[model samples]
Target: MKKLFILCVFLLAGCATQTPSKTPSACSEEQACTIGDQNTVETMQPLSFEEALSFFKEKKSGLLYFGFENCPWCQEALPILREEAKRQNVSIHSILTRDENNELLYTEEQKQEIIPYLQDYMSKNEEGELTLYVPLVVVVKDGKAIEGHVGTVDDHDAHARKMTEEEKQELQKKYEDMLAQLSS
Candidate 1:
Protein backbone atom coordinates (compact mmCIF):
# COMPACT_ATOMS: atom_id res chain seq x y z
CA MET A 1 0.00 0.00 0.00
CA LYS A 2 2.84 2.43 0.78
CA LYS A 3 4.57 1.73 -2.56
CA LEU A 4 1.29 2.30 -4.41
CA PHE A 5 0.80 5.58 -2.56
CA ILE A 6 4.32 6.75 -3.43
CA LEU A 7 3.78 5.84 -7.11
CA CYS A 8 0.58 7.85 -7.19
CA VAL A 9 2.37 10.85 -5.77
CA PHE A 10 5.16 10.57 -8.35
CA LEU A 11 2.64 10.33 -11.21
CA LEU A 12 0.76 13.38 -10.01
CA ALA A 13 3.92 15.43 -9.76
CA GLY A 14 4.98 14.44 -13.32
CA CYS A 15 1.57 15.41 -14.63
CA ALA A 16 1.95 18.88 -13.18
CA THR A 17 5.26 19.38 -15.01
CA GLN A 18 3.89 18.35 -18.41
CA THR A 19 3.12 21.07 -20.93
CA PRO A 20 -0.21 21.10 -22.70
CA SER A 21 -0.51 19.28 -26.00
CA LYS A 22 0.18 21.24 -29.18
CA THR A 23 -2.68 22.40 -31.37
CA PRO A 24 -3.78 20.39 -34.40
CA SER A 25 -3.41 21.31 -38.09
CA ALA A 26 -5.87 23.99 -39.07
CA CYS A 27 -6.43 22.92 -42.69
CA SER A 28 -7.43 19.84 -44.57
CA GLU A 29 -7.03 19.63 -48.38
CA GLU A 30 -10.77 20.01 -48.92
CA GLN A 31 -10.86 23.57 -47.66
CA ALA A 32 -7.59 24.81 -49.16
CA CYS A 33 -7.79 23.80 -52.82
CA THR A 34 -10.60 24.11 -55.30
CA ILE A 35 -11.10 24.95 -58.97
CA GLY A 36 -12.50 27.91 -61.01
CA ASP A 37 -11.84 31.19 -59.23
CA GLN A 38 -9.62 34.20 -59.76
CA ASN A 39 -8.91 34.21 -56.02
CA THR A 40 -7.92 30.62 -55.80
CA VAL A 41 -5.51 29.82 -52.97
CA GLU A 42 -3.57 26.68 -53.88
CA THR A 43 -0.17 27.26 -52.35
CA MET A 44 1.52 29.25 -49.61
CA GLN A 45 4.76 31.16 -49.18
CA PRO A 46 5.61 31.56 -45.54
CA LEU A 47 7.40 34.31 -43.55
CA SER A 48 7.27 35.26 -39.92
CA PHE A 49 5.05 38.19 -38.98
CA GLU A 50 8.08 40.44 -38.37
CA GLU A 51 9.55 39.57 -41.77
CA ALA A 52 6.18 40.18 -43.41
CA LEU A 53 5.86 43.52 -41.65
CA SER A 54 9.35 44.53 -42.74
CA PHE A 55 8.54 43.54 -46.28
CA PHE A 56 5.23 45.36 -46.12
CA LYS A 57 6.83 48.53 -44.78
CA GLU A 58 9.27 48.57 -47.67
CA LYS A 59 6.61 47.64 -50.20
CA LYS A 60 4.22 50.27 -48.83
CA SER A 61 1.48 47.75 -47.89
CA GLY A 62 1.01 44.35 -46.25
CA LEU A 63 -1.59 41.83 -45.06
CA LEU A 64 -1.42 39.83 -41.86
CA TYR A 65 -3.41 36.78 -40.76
CA PHE A 66 -3.32 35.79 -37.07
CA GLY A 67 -4.60 32.35 -36.11
CA PHE A 68 -3.66 29.40 -33.95
CA GLU A 69 -3.23 25.83 -35.23
CA ASN A 70 -6.10 24.19 -33.40
CA CYS A 71 -8.66 26.70 -34.65
CA PRO A 72 -10.93 25.48 -37.47
CA TRP A 73 -11.30 28.88 -39.07
CA CYS A 74 -7.60 29.46 -38.84
CA GLN A 75 -6.98 26.21 -40.70
CA GLU A 76 -9.35 27.31 -43.45
CA ALA A 77 -7.87 30.80 -43.61
CA LEU A 78 -4.24 29.74 -43.87
CA PRO A 79 -4.72 27.92 -47.16
CA ILE A 80 -6.59 30.87 -48.55
CA LEU A 81 -3.62 33.05 -47.76
CA ARG A 82 -1.30 30.55 -49.37
CA GLU A 83 -3.42 30.34 -52.48
CA GLU A 84 -3.52 34.09 -52.74
CA ALA A 85 0.22 34.30 -52.27
CA LYS A 86 0.85 31.69 -54.90
CA ARG A 87 -1.57 33.10 -57.48
CA GLN A 88 -0.17 36.55 -56.81
CA ASN A 89 3.39 35.22 -56.66
CA VAL A 90 3.76 36.50 -53.11
CA SER A 91 4.90 34.99 -49.81
CA ILE A 92 2.82 34.47 -46.70
CA HIS A 93 4.26 33.63 -43.31
CA SER A 94 2.37 31.65 -40.69
CA ILE A 95 2.66 32.37 -36.99
CA LEU A 96 1.71 29.23 -35.12
CA THR A 97 -0.55 29.51 -32.07
CA ARG A 98 1.73 27.15 -30.25
CA ASP A 99 4.81 25.35 -31.57
CA GLU A 100 5.98 22.72 -29.10
CA ASN A 101 8.18 20.81 -31.59
CA ASN A 102 9.78 23.73 -33.46
CA GLU A 103 8.18 22.64 -36.76
CA LEU A 104 7.82 26.23 -37.95
CA LEU A 105 11.09 27.09 -36.24
CA TYR A 106 9.31 29.36 -33.81
CA THR A 107 11.14 29.48 -30.52
CA GLU A 108 9.29 30.21 -27.29
CA GLU A 109 10.80 33.69 -27.14
CA GLN A 110 10.01 34.48 -30.78
CA LYS A 111 6.44 33.23 -30.41
CA GLN A 112 5.99 35.38 -27.33
CA GLU A 113 7.32 38.46 -29.11
CA ILE A 114 5.29 37.97 -32.32
CA ILE A 115 1.90 37.33 -30.68
CA PRO A 116 1.84 40.76 -29.02
CA TYR A 117 2.73 42.54 -32.25
CA LEU A 118 -0.05 40.74 -34.12
CA GLN A 119 -2.64 41.30 -31.40
CA ASP A 120 -1.81 44.99 -31.22
CA TYR A 121 -1.72 45.64 -34.94
CA MET A 122 -4.25 43.17 -36.32
CA SER A 123 -6.95 42.67 -33.72
CA LYS A 124 -7.39 46.26 -32.48
CA ASN A 125 -10.96 47.56 -32.76
CA GLU A 126 -11.88 50.95 -34.16
CA GLU A 127 -13.92 52.46 -31.31
CA GLY A 128 -12.13 51.00 -28.31
CA GLU A 129 -9.09 49.67 -30.24
CA LEU A 130 -9.26 46.58 -28.07
CA THR A 131 -9.65 43.06 -29.51
CA LEU A 132 -11.30 39.91 -28.18
CA TYR A 133 -10.96 37.55 -31.12
CA VAL A 134 -8.37 34.90 -31.88
CA PRO A 135 -8.42 34.53 -35.68
CA LEU A 136 -8.02 38.08 -36.86
CA VAL A 137 -6.54 39.90 -39.85
CA VAL A 138 -5.22 43.39 -40.46
CA VAL A 139 -4.25 45.31 -43.54
CA VAL A 140 -1.73 48.11 -43.01
CA LYS A 141 0.46 50.36 -45.06
CA ASP A 142 2.54 53.49 -44.47
CA GLY A 143 1.51 53.41 -40.81
CA LYS A 144 -2.18 53.42 -41.66
CA ALA A 145 -5.10 51.02 -41.42
CA ILE A 146 -6.53 49.69 -44.65
CA GLU A 147 -8.94 46.84 -43.80
CA GLY A 148 -9.05 44.60 -40.78
CA HIS A 149 -10.98 41.48 -39.72
CA VAL A 150 -11.60 41.07 -36.01
CA GLY A 151 -12.69 37.45 -36.33
CA THR A 152 -13.44 36.85 -39.98
CA VAL A 153 -12.17 33.60 -41.41
CA ASP A 154 -10.71 33.17 -44.90
CA ASP A 155 -13.79 31.23 -45.98
CA HIS A 156 -15.77 34.36 -45.24
CA ASP A 157 -17.61 35.76 -48.26
CA ALA A 158 -15.35 38.79 -48.05
CA HIS A 159 -12.19 36.77 -48.63
CA ALA A 160 -13.12 33.44 -50.25
CA ARG A 161 -15.83 31.42 -51.94
CA LYS A 162 -14.94 28.16 -50.28
CA MET A 163 -13.65 25.42 -52.63
CA THR A 164 -15.30 26.77 -55.75
CA GLU A 165 -14.11 28.85 -58.69
CA GLU A 166 -16.30 31.84 -57.93
CA GLU A 167 -15.20 31.68 -54.33
CA LYS A 168 -11.61 31.95 -55.48
CA GLN A 169 -12.41 35.10 -57.43
CA GLU A 170 -14.11 36.65 -54.45
CA LEU A 171 -11.11 35.96 -52.25
CA GLN A 172 -8.87 37.55 -54.86
CA LYS A 173 -11.05 40.64 -55.05
CA LYS A 174 -11.06 40.96 -51.28
CA TYR A 175 -7.28 40.72 -51.20
CA GLU A 176 -6.93 43.38 -53.87
CA ASP A 177 -9.51 45.54 -52.17
CA MET A 178 -7.69 45.22 -48.88
CA LEU A 179 -4.43 46.20 -50.58
CA ALA A 180 -6.04 49.15 -52.25
CA GLN A 181 -7.47 50.29 -48.97
CA LEU A 182 -4.06 50.08 -47.33
CA SER A 183 -2.08 51.66 -50.16
CA SER A 184 -4.50 54.50 -50.65
Candidate 2:
Protein backbone atom coordinates (compact mmCIF):
# COMPACT_ATOMS: atom_id res chain seq x y z
CA MET A 1 0.00 0.00 0.00
CA LYS A 2 2.82 2.40 0.82
CA LYS A 3 4.57 1.71 -2.54
CA LEU A 4 1.30 2.15 -4.44
CA PHE A 5 0.66 5.50 -2.77
CA ILE A 6 4.14 6.72 -3.65
CA LEU A 7 3.73 5.68 -7.26
CA CYS A 8 0.42 7.51 -7.51
CA VAL A 9 1.98 10.65 -6.09
CA PHE A 10 4.85 10.46 -8.54
CA LEU A 11 2.46 10.05 -11.47
CA LEU A 12 0.39 13.02 -10.34
CA ALA A 13 3.50 15.13 -9.96
CA GLY A 14 4.70 14.20 -13.42
CA CYS A 15 1.40 15.19 -14.89
CA ALA A 16 1.35 18.43 -12.97
CA THR A 17 4.84 19.37 -14.10
CA GLN A 18 4.19 18.70 -17.76
CA THR A 19 4.48 21.81 -19.89
CA PRO A 20 1.50 23.10 -21.82
CA SER A 21 1.78 23.23 -25.60
CA LYS A 22 2.34 26.60 -27.23
CA THR A 23 0.20 25.68 -30.23
CA PRO A 24 -2.73 28.03 -30.44
CA SER A 25 -6.33 26.95 -30.39
CA ALA A 26 -9.37 28.85 -31.51
CA CYS A 27 -9.71 31.72 -29.09
CA SER A 28 -12.75 32.62 -27.03
CA GLU A 29 -13.72 36.26 -26.64
CA GLU A 30 -12.39 36.29 -23.09
CA GLN A 31 -9.06 34.86 -24.20
CA ALA A 32 -8.85 36.99 -27.34
CA CYS A 33 -9.50 40.23 -25.51
CA THR A 34 -6.46 39.82 -23.29
CA ILE A 35 -4.09 37.84 -25.53
CA GLY A 36 -2.29 40.91 -26.77
CA ASP A 37 -2.43 44.68 -26.81
CA GLN A 38 -3.37 46.91 -29.74
CA ASN A 39 0.20 47.11 -31.02
CA THR A 40 0.61 43.34 -31.38
CA VAL A 41 1.57 43.50 -35.07
CA GLU A 42 4.95 44.24 -36.62
CA THR A 43 4.61 48.00 -36.29
CA MET A 44 4.56 48.56 -32.56
CA GLN A 45 3.26 52.11 -32.80
CA PRO A 46 0.26 53.45 -34.70
CA LEU A 47 1.51 54.45 -38.13
CA SER A 48 1.35 57.99 -39.39
CA PHE A 49 0.05 58.49 -42.94
CA GLU A 50 3.50 58.84 -44.39
CA GLU A 51 4.81 55.92 -42.35
CA ALA A 52 2.02 53.68 -43.55
CA LEU A 53 2.56 54.66 -47.15
CA SER A 54 6.26 54.10 -46.78
CA PHE A 55 5.75 50.66 -45.24
CA PHE A 56 3.69 49.47 -48.20
CA LYS A 57 6.06 50.99 -50.66
CA GLU A 58 9.07 49.30 -49.12
CA LYS A 59 7.66 45.93 -48.16
CA LYS A 60 5.59 45.60 -51.35
CA SER A 61 3.87 42.56 -49.86
CA GLY A 62 2.31 42.32 -46.44
CA LEU A 63 -0.94 42.11 -44.52
CA LEU A 64 -2.70 45.21 -43.25
CA TYR A 65 -5.25 44.87 -40.47
CA PHE A 66 -7.55 47.79 -39.62
CA GLY A 67 -9.42 47.52 -36.40
CA PHE A 68 -10.46 49.35 -33.29
CA GLU A 69 -9.70 48.12 -29.78
CA ASN A 70 -13.29 47.76 -28.66
CA CYS A 71 -14.81 46.32 -31.79
CA PRO A 72 -16.06 42.84 -30.97
CA TRP A 73 -15.16 41.51 -34.39
CA CYS A 74 -11.67 42.97 -34.08
CA GLN A 75 -11.23 41.30 -30.73
CA GLU A 76 -12.30 37.99 -32.20
CA ALA A 77 -10.26 38.34 -35.37
CA LEU A 78 -6.94 39.53 -33.98
CA PRO A 79 -5.85 36.35 -32.25
CA ILE A 80 -6.54 34.20 -35.26
CA LEU A 81 -4.83 36.74 -37.47
CA ARG A 82 -1.73 36.77 -35.31
CA GLU A 83 -1.39 33.01 -35.20
CA GLU A 84 -1.83 32.56 -38.93
CA ALA A 85 0.42 35.47 -39.78
CA LYS A 86 3.18 34.00 -37.68
CA ARG A 87 2.76 30.53 -39.13
CA GLN A 88 2.74 31.82 -42.70
CA ASN A 89 5.72 34.08 -42.05
CA VAL A 90 3.84 37.16 -43.20
CA SER A 91 4.44 40.68 -41.99
CA ILE A 92 1.32 42.31 -40.61
CA HIS A 93 0.64 45.98 -39.91
CA SER A 94 -2.17 47.08 -37.64
CA ILE A 95 -4.12 50.32 -37.84
CA LEU A 96 -6.18 51.27 -34.83
CA THR A 97 -9.09 53.57 -35.56
CA ARG A 98 -10.81 53.93 -32.20
CA ASP A 99 -10.46 53.43 -28.50
CA GLU A 100 -12.44 51.23 -26.16
CA ASN A 101 -15.09 53.91 -25.75
CA ASN A 102 -15.52 54.15 -29.55
CA GLU A 103 -13.82 57.52 -29.62
CA LEU A 104 -12.01 58.24 -32.86
CA LEU A 105 -8.29 57.75 -32.40
CA TYR A 106 -6.94 58.49 -35.87
CA THR A 107 -5.83 62.04 -36.61
CA GLU A 108 -7.42 63.99 -39.45
CA GLU A 109 -4.12 64.00 -41.28
CA GLN A 110 -3.85 60.24 -40.87
CA LYS A 111 -7.45 59.85 -42.00
CA GLN A 112 -6.82 61.85 -45.11
CA GLU A 113 -4.34 59.24 -46.27
CA ILE A 114 -5.93 56.15 -44.70
CA ILE A 115 -9.49 56.84 -45.80
CA PRO A 116 -8.53 56.99 -49.45
CA TYR A 117 -6.51 53.79 -49.24
CA LEU A 118 -9.37 52.07 -47.45
CA GLN A 119 -11.86 53.43 -49.92
CA ASP A 120 -10.14 51.40 -52.60
CA TYR A 121 -11.09 48.33 -50.58
CA MET A 122 -14.62 49.42 -49.70
CA SER A 123 -17.71 47.92 -51.21
CA LYS A 124 -20.10 50.15 -53.10
CA ASN A 125 -23.76 50.53 -52.28
CA GLU A 126 -26.40 50.85 -54.93
CA GLU A 127 -26.10 54.59 -54.50
CA GLY A 128 -22.36 54.31 -55.27
CA GLU A 129 -21.28 55.38 -51.82
CA LEU A 130 -18.47 53.51 -50.10
CA THR A 131 -19.64 51.05 -47.47
CA LEU A 132 -16.96 50.75 -44.86
CA TYR A 133 -16.75 48.04 -42.24
CA VAL A 134 -14.61 47.42 -39.19
CA PRO A 135 -11.99 44.71 -38.79
CA LEU A 136 -10.99 45.01 -42.40
CA VAL A 137 -7.90 43.28 -43.77
CA VAL A 138 -6.14 44.26 -46.97
CA VAL A 139 -3.59 42.12 -48.75
CA VAL A 140 -1.08 44.29 -50.58
CA LYS A 141 1.71 43.39 -52.98
CA ASP A 142 3.91 45.31 -55.40
CA GLY A 143 2.51 48.53 -53.96
CA LYS A 144 -1.01 47.54 -54.94
CA ALA A 145 -3.89 46.22 -52.94
CA ILE A 146 -4.58 42.62 -53.96
CA GLU A 147 -7.68 41.80 -51.97
CA GLY A 148 -9.64 42.88 -48.93
CA HIS A 149 -11.61 40.89 -46.40
CA VAL A 150 -14.07 42.37 -43.95
CA GLY A 151 -14.78 40.84 -40.54
CA THR A 152 -13.55 37.66 -38.93
CA VAL A 153 -13.26 34.51 -41.00
CA ASP A 154 -14.41 32.66 -37.92
CA ASP A 155 -17.95 32.65 -36.70
CA HIS A 156 -19.25 36.19 -36.09
CA ASP A 157 -21.48 34.96 -33.26
CA ALA A 158 -18.40 34.34 -31.20
CA HIS A 159 -19.99 35.07 -27.85
CA ALA A 160 -22.59 32.37 -28.38
CA ARG A 161 -20.57 29.87 -30.39
CA LYS A 162 -17.25 28.09 -30.18
CA MET A 163 -15.40 26.58 -33.11
CA THR A 164 -14.07 23.05 -33.05
CA GLU A 165 -10.39 22.32 -33.68
CA GLU A 166 -11.08 21.15 -37.23
CA GLU A 167 -12.94 24.36 -37.95
CA LYS A 168 -10.04 26.37 -36.66
CA GLN A 169 -7.63 24.49 -38.92
CA GLU A 170 -9.84 25.15 -41.90
CA LEU A 171 -9.97 28.84 -41.14
CA GLN A 172 -6.20 28.97 -40.78
CA LYS A 173 -5.75 27.21 -44.08
CA LYS A 174 -8.07 29.67 -45.76
CA TYR A 175 -5.99 32.54 -44.52
CA GLU A 176 -2.80 30.79 -45.56
CA ASP A 177 -4.08 30.28 -49.07
CA MET A 178 -5.25 33.85 -49.29
CA LEU A 179 -1.88 35.18 -48.20
CA ALA A 180 -0.06 32.84 -50.54
CA GLN A 181 -2.08 34.10 -53.46
CA LEU A 182 -1.17 37.65 -52.63
CA SER A 183 2.51 36.82 -52.35
CA SER A 184 2.51 34.85 -55.56
Candidate 3:
Protein backbone atom coordinates (compact mmCIF):
# COMPACT_ATOMS: atom_id res chain seq x y z
CA MET A 1 0.00 0.00 0.00
CA LYS A 2 2.87 2.38 0.82
CA LYS A 3 4.59 1.51 -2.48
CA LEU A 4 1.32 2.18 -4.34
CA PHE A 5 0.94 5.60 -2.67
CA ILE A 6 4.56 6.55 -3.46
CA LEU A 7 4.07 5.45 -7.12
CA CYS A 8 0.92 7.53 -7.42
CA VAL A 9 2.66 10.58 -5.91
CA PHE A 10 5.60 10.19 -8.31
CA LEU A 11 3.26 9.88 -11.26
CA LEU A 12 1.33 12.96 -10.18
CA ALA A 13 4.53 14.93 -9.66
CA GLY A 14 5.82 13.92 -13.09
CA CYS A 15 2.59 14.96 -14.76
CA ALA A 16 2.58 18.29 -12.94
CA THR A 17 6.15 19.05 -13.94
CA GLN A 18 5.54 18.34 -17.61
CA THR A 19 5.03 21.41 -19.73
CA PRO A 20 1.57 21.91 -21.15
CA SER A 21 1.31 21.34 -24.89
CA LYS A 22 0.92 24.36 -27.10
CA THR A 23 -2.03 24.62 -29.45
CA PRO A 24 -1.22 23.15 -32.85
CA SER A 25 -0.38 25.87 -35.30
CA ALA A 26 -2.47 26.19 -38.49
CA CYS A 27 0.59 25.57 -40.63
CA SER A 28 -0.12 23.05 -43.40
CA GLU A 29 2.99 22.09 -45.35
CA GLU A 30 5.92 20.34 -43.70
CA GLN A 31 7.14 23.88 -43.19
CA ALA A 32 5.67 27.28 -44.07
CA CYS A 33 6.69 27.09 -47.74
CA THR A 34 4.72 30.23 -48.49
CA ILE A 35 5.98 32.32 -45.56
CA GLY A 36 9.31 30.57 -44.70
CA ASP A 37 10.72 29.39 -41.33
CA GLN A 38 8.74 27.27 -38.91
CA ASN A 39 8.58 29.99 -36.26
CA THR A 40 7.19 32.69 -38.53
CA VAL A 41 5.11 30.26 -40.52
CA GLU A 42 3.46 28.86 -37.41
CA THR A 43 2.26 32.32 -36.44
CA MET A 44 -0.07 32.58 -39.46
CA GLN A 45 -3.00 30.53 -40.64
CA PRO A 46 -2.73 29.71 -44.34
CA LEU A 47 -5.89 30.26 -46.38
CA SER A 48 -6.76 29.82 -50.02
CA PHE A 49 -7.66 32.86 -52.09
CA GLU A 50 -11.22 31.53 -52.18
CA GLU A 51 -11.26 31.13 -48.43
CA ALA A 52 -9.92 34.63 -47.97
CA LEU A 53 -12.57 35.99 -50.33
CA SER A 54 -15.24 34.26 -48.31
CA PHE A 55 -14.08 36.07 -45.17
CA PHE A 56 -14.32 39.40 -46.94
CA LYS A 57 -17.71 38.50 -48.38
CA GLU A 58 -18.94 37.42 -44.99
CA LYS A 59 -17.67 40.67 -43.47
CA LYS A 60 -15.45 38.86 -40.98
CA SER A 61 -13.00 41.14 -39.25
CA GLY A 62 -9.40 39.96 -39.15
CA LEU A 63 -5.84 40.55 -40.32
CA LEU A 64 -4.75 39.28 -43.71
CA TYR A 65 -1.11 39.12 -44.82
CA PHE A 66 -0.05 38.41 -48.39
CA GLY A 67 3.45 37.15 -49.07
CA PHE A 68 5.52 34.14 -50.04
CA GLU A 69 8.81 32.63 -48.91
CA ASN A 70 10.63 33.74 -52.03
CA CYS A 71 9.94 37.39 -51.33
CA PRO A 72 12.98 38.91 -49.66
CA TRP A 73 10.89 41.59 -48.04
CA CYS A 74 8.53 38.99 -46.69
CA GLN A 75 11.44 37.06 -45.21
CA GLU A 76 12.55 40.15 -43.35
CA ALA A 77 9.15 41.43 -42.25
CA LEU A 78 7.34 38.20 -41.32
CA PRO A 79 9.27 37.58 -38.12
CA ILE A 80 8.64 41.10 -36.91
CA LEU A 81 4.98 40.85 -37.86
CA ARG A 82 4.72 37.56 -35.97
CA GLU A 83 6.21 39.15 -32.87
CA GLU A 84 3.86 42.11 -33.09
CA ALA A 85 0.83 39.88 -33.61
CA LYS A 86 1.80 37.87 -30.55
CA ARG A 87 2.23 41.03 -28.50
CA GLN A 88 -1.19 42.24 -29.64
CA ASN A 89 -2.70 38.79 -29.11
CA VAL A 90 -4.02 38.73 -32.68
CA SER A 91 -4.23 35.93 -35.21
CA ILE A 92 -3.07 36.56 -38.78
CA HIS A 93 -4.37 34.91 -41.91
CA SER A 94 -1.84 34.49 -44.72
CA ILE A 95 -2.04 33.68 -48.40
CA LEU A 96 0.71 32.51 -50.67
CA THR A 97 1.47 35.07 -53.34
CA ARG A 98 3.47 32.51 -55.22
CA ASP A 99 3.90 28.77 -55.33
CA GLU A 100 7.10 26.86 -54.49
CA ASN A 101 8.29 27.34 -58.04
CA ASN A 102 7.82 31.08 -57.69
CA GLU A 103 4.80 31.10 -59.97
CA LEU A 104 1.90 33.41 -59.31
CA LEU A 105 -0.82 31.66 -57.32
CA TYR A 106 -3.74 33.57 -58.75
CA THR A 107 -4.51 33.99 -62.40
CA GLU A 108 -5.22 37.41 -63.87
CA GLU A 109 -8.85 36.45 -64.20
CA GLN A 110 -9.03 35.44 -60.57
CA LYS A 111 -7.28 38.62 -59.58
CA GLN A 112 -9.81 40.64 -61.55
CA GLU A 113 -12.59 38.90 -59.68
CA ILE A 114 -11.24 39.86 -56.28
CA ILE A 115 -9.86 43.25 -57.26
CA PRO A 116 -12.95 45.12 -56.12
CA TYR A 117 -12.78 43.60 -52.67
CA LEU A 118 -9.08 44.49 -52.30
CA GLN A 119 -8.88 47.58 -54.47
CA ASP A 120 -8.13 49.77 -51.53
CA TYR A 121 -5.25 47.57 -50.47
CA MET A 122 -3.62 47.59 -53.93
CA SER A 123 -1.84 50.28 -55.84
CA LYS A 124 -1.90 51.32 -59.46
CA ASN A 125 1.29 51.28 -61.46
CA GLU A 126 2.48 53.83 -64.02
CA GLU A 127 0.46 51.93 -66.61
CA GLY A 128 -2.63 52.43 -64.45
CA GLU A 129 -2.98 48.73 -63.79
CA LEU A 130 -3.79 47.52 -60.32
CA THR A 131 -0.82 45.75 -58.79
CA LEU A 132 -0.70 43.57 -55.74
CA TYR A 133 2.51 43.60 -53.78
CA VAL A 134 3.74 41.06 -51.28
CA PRO A 135 4.21 41.57 -47.56
CA LEU A 136 1.00 43.56 -47.61
CA VAL A 137 -1.04 43.52 -44.42
CA VAL A 138 -4.67 44.51 -44.51
CA VAL A 139 -7.02 44.95 -41.58
CA VAL A 140 -10.54 44.04 -42.65
CA LYS A 141 -13.57 45.00 -40.61
CA ASP A 142 -17.18 44.41 -41.57
CA GLY A 143 -15.99 43.37 -45.05
CA LYS A 144 -14.27 46.68 -45.60
CA ALA A 145 -10.49 47.02 -45.64
CA ILE A 146 -10.10 49.73 -43.06
CA GLU A 147 -6.31 49.84 -43.04
CA GLY A 148 -3.43 48.48 -45.07
CA HIS A 149 0.34 48.62 -44.94
CA VAL A 150 2.86 47.42 -47.48
CA GLY A 151 6.44 46.31 -46.85
CA THR A 152 8.52 47.44 -43.90
CA VAL A 153 9.61 50.95 -43.03
CA ASP A 154 9.86 53.59 -45.69
CA ASP A 155 13.61 54.05 -45.08
CA HIS A 156 14.50 50.37 -45.23
CA ASP A 157 13.81 50.04 -48.94
CA ALA A 158 16.03 47.08 -49.75
CA HIS A 159 14.97 43.58 -48.73
CA ALA A 160 18.39 41.95 -49.27
CA ARG A 161 19.68 43.34 -45.97
CA LYS A 162 18.22 43.38 -42.47
CA MET A 163 16.51 46.30 -40.80
CA THR A 164 18.45 48.36 -38.23
CA GLU A 165 17.27 48.79 -34.66
CA GLU A 166 15.61 52.11 -35.49
CA GLU A 167 13.91 50.65 -38.54
CA LYS A 168 12.69 47.67 -36.52
CA GLN A 169 11.32 49.98 -33.85
CA GLU A 170 9.56 52.06 -36.46
CA LEU A 171 8.12 48.97 -38.11
CA GLN A 172 6.91 47.63 -34.78
CA LYS A 173 5.21 50.92 -34.10
CA LYS A 174 3.60 50.82 -37.53
CA TYR A 175 2.31 47.31 -36.89
CA GLU A 176 1.05 48.31 -33.46
CA ASP A 177 -0.69 51.32 -34.94
CA MET A 178 -2.29 49.24 -37.66
CA LEU A 179 -3.35 46.52 -35.24
CA ALA A 180 -4.74 49.10 -32.82
CA GLN A 181 -7.32 50.02 -35.44
CA LEU A 182 -8.66 46.49 -35.38
CA SER A 183 -10.14 46.91 -31.92
CA SER A 184 -11.61 50.26 -32.79
| Candidate number with the higher lDDT (1 or 2) | 2
Per-residue lDDT over 1-184 for candidate 3, one digit per residue giving the tens place of the 0 to 100 score = 9999999999999999976534332345343323333334335677877777888889999899888877878877877887788777677888877876899878888788778878887888899999888789989999888888888878676545788898888888888998888878
lDDT minimum window of 10 residues, candidate 2: 26-35
Give the best candidate by lDDT: 3
**Runs in model 2 lying further than 4 Å from the true structure:** 1-46, 53-59, 107-116, 124-131, 158-167
Query: What are the TM-scores, per candidate, against the unseen true structure?
Result: 0.42, 0.59, 0.76
TM-score of 1: 0.42
Per-candidate RMSD vs. true structure?
15.5, 7.5, 5.7
- Please tell me which model should have the higher TM-score, number 2 or number 3: 3
Question: How large an RMSD does model 1 have?
Answer: 15.5
- Per-residue lDDT over 1-184 for candidate 1, one digit per residue giving the tens place of the 0 to 100 score: 9999999999999999976532224422123323224344432333454664464446545555555665555555555555555555443334343344324434445545444445554444587544435455566665444466544334454344334566546655666565455335
What's the lDDT for candidate 1? Answer: 0.50
Q: Ranking under lDDT, best-scoring first?
A: 3, 2, 1
Model 2 clash pairs are none
